[model samples]
Target: MDERIEISMLLDFYGSMLTDKQRDIMYLYYNEDFSLAEISEHTNTSRQAIFDIVKRCNKILIEYEDKLKLLEKFMKLTKTKELILNKLNEIDSSCDNIKISNSINEIINEINNI
Candidate 1:
């Protein structure tokens, strides 16, 4: 995965563990695409301080992912769900089972929402 994307996913998985300031800084820097100077100005801190906080938050998010593997499992399950849906599509087309296909699609949608 791309570095930015990976960090974004890590933030999603582990952001709640961070302090409010840490989470807000990360959300601005990563999710909102704010520059360090921008975050510093917005938060009334030095640019260097913003930079340090962002760096620490990034490390903490990675550490959480490394230990818990929640994001890893989530990615694997999402991929598996996609594959299952593809196979189900193939089978449904061949077998002409509308009711079964609709039921499977509903289940897949529920899983995706999770």
Candidate 2:
């Protein structure tokens, strides 16, 4: 994955655990695509302070992912979802019986529940 995309995912997974200010800085830097100096100006802090906070937030997000692994599980589930959908499509196309059609719909509903 791209570094920016990975950080965005990490932030999504663990951002609630961060301080309000930490989240804000990270949001601006990553989500809003703001430069460090721009973040400093927006937050009224020194650029060095903003830089340190961004660095710390990155460490914290990575630590949370290392221990919690929410992102990993999410990626796995996403891949599994695709596989399930493909298999369901195959099964649906191969079986035209009404019962099999209903079963496929049920299976699709269950996948959506997941």
Candidate 3:
């Protein structure tokens, strides 16, 4: 998996466990792609403080994921969602061919009903 995606899942899985301040700093740095200096300026903190906070947040998030496997579960869920989306796209593309056949439409309607 991509490192960014892994980190993103880790952040999502473990963010709620962090203090609001930590969460805010992490989101600013990771999710919003803010530089440490930028975050410091925005939050009215020193760069070193932002750096320490982000590092601490990373450690906490990592520990949480390691203990709980929440990130793993989230990653699996993401993969499943992508698979379903791809399958749906394939079905959509095939619909053009299947449109001429009533049976396929019936099957599609049945699947949709389910």
The root-mean-square deviation over C-alpha atoms between each candidate and the true structure, in angstroms, is 1.7, 1.6, 5.1
- For candidate 2, the per-residue lDDT at 40 reads 89
Ranking by lDDT: 2, 1, 3
TM-score of every prediction relative to native: 0.88, 0.88, 0.66
Clashing pairs in 1: none
Off-target runs (Cα >4 Å) in candidate 3 are 80-114
Report the Cα lDDT for candidate 2.
Answer: 0.94
lDDT of 2 by residue, 1-114 (tens): 998899999999999999999999999999999999999889999999999999999999999999999999999999999999999989999897989889998999899889
lDDT of 2 at 87: 92
Against the reference, the lDDT scores of all candidates come to 0.88, 0.94, 0.77
Model 1, position 93, has a per-residue lDDT of 70
Tens-digit lDDT string for candidate 1 (14-45): 98999999999999999999999999999999
The list of candidate 1 runs beyond 4 A from truth reads none
User: Which 10 consecutive positions of candidate 2 have the poorest summed lDDT?
Assistant: 89-98
Which candidate number has the best lDDT? 2
- The 10 consecutive residues of candidate 3 with the worst lDDT sum are 105-114
